[model samples]
Target: GAGVSQTPSNKVTEKGKYVELRCDPISGHTALYWYRQSLGQGPEFLIYFQGTGAADDSGLPNDRFFAVRPEGSVSTLKIQRTERGDSAVYLCASSPGLGLSGANVLTFGAGSRLTVL
Candidate 1:
């Protein structure tokens, strides 16, 4: 992919349904990240993958949220038993490396909008 790409762009679902969002990252990038952005806040990091392994997953709010990068190129985020509080834009980003001091710039996808009712 030239840049990160996410599917559906917008999804509307009833509360308690399961949904899967996909992300395709830039080619050759070694790092991928998932984030959730609420209405008025910045993107909060949910998980980070360096290659095929999850290097950090501390931002996932609960057991209902999970993500995977099976082959290190594309990833999916699955939400189980979704809540109204889960309505937000899910963002995906990729970088060459996890630079020190948070200096690395992530090229972000437009994002998948998940709306729970």
Candidate 2:
């Protein structure tokens, strides 16, 4: 896809269930990011992958939240023991490798909205 793509645009689940959200990035993009946006808040960074490895994941709130980019092009965010507070829009973004001169703008997907019941 020309832009990032996220699956399961809407998910409704019970608390304590496990959920996996998938993100397919634009081909050839080397940097991918996962973020969560709650009501009345901006997207909060969850993780960033440079190639297949996680370059930064300090944004993850707890051990239950995990993200992986195993092959560099595709990434997934996994939430274990979901809670009502976990409900939010999971956003995926990607960009060409960062340049030395300045910051890079990321291309974002529509995001997957999760609602915990």
Candidate 3:
């Protein structure tokens, strides 16, 4: 796809298991983000990366969740000790830049559905 891309569109895991979600953004995009959406709720921001560094990660629920953009392009989200409450759609987005001017503008990919049993 020309826009953002997410792998393993659907995932089912047992409680306490670990899972990883991947995202690939547009070629020239410099900003990437991860979001989580549970049933009947709005998407919640999880993390944001600019270039190869995490620009904002305060949204992450706890130390169990982490994300990385090793080369400033593709990113991966890792979840540890998965719980049923953690089940949600993981979304990936990218933009040309960050900050006030382009913060609201983003190209989002189809989310990854996760179910923890």
Steric clash pairs (candidate 2): none
Instruction: Note the Cα lDDT for every prediction shown.
Output: 0.94, 0.93, 0.94
Residue-by-residue lDDT tens digits, candidate 3, 31-94: 9999999989998999999999998899999999999999999999999999898999999999
lDDT of 1 at 62: 95
Error of 1 at 29 (Å): 0.6
Lowest lDDT 10-mer window, candidate 3? 96-105
**Over the full model, what C-alpha lDDT does candidate 1 score relative to the true structure?**
0.94
Residue-wise lDDT of candidate 1 within 1-117, one digit each (tens)?
A: 788999979999999999999999999888999999999999999999999899999999999999999998899999999999999999999988776746567999999999999
Return the lDDT, model 2, position 37. 99
What CA RMSD would you report for each candidate?
Answer: 1.5, 1.3, 1.3
For model 1, name the residue pairs that clash. none
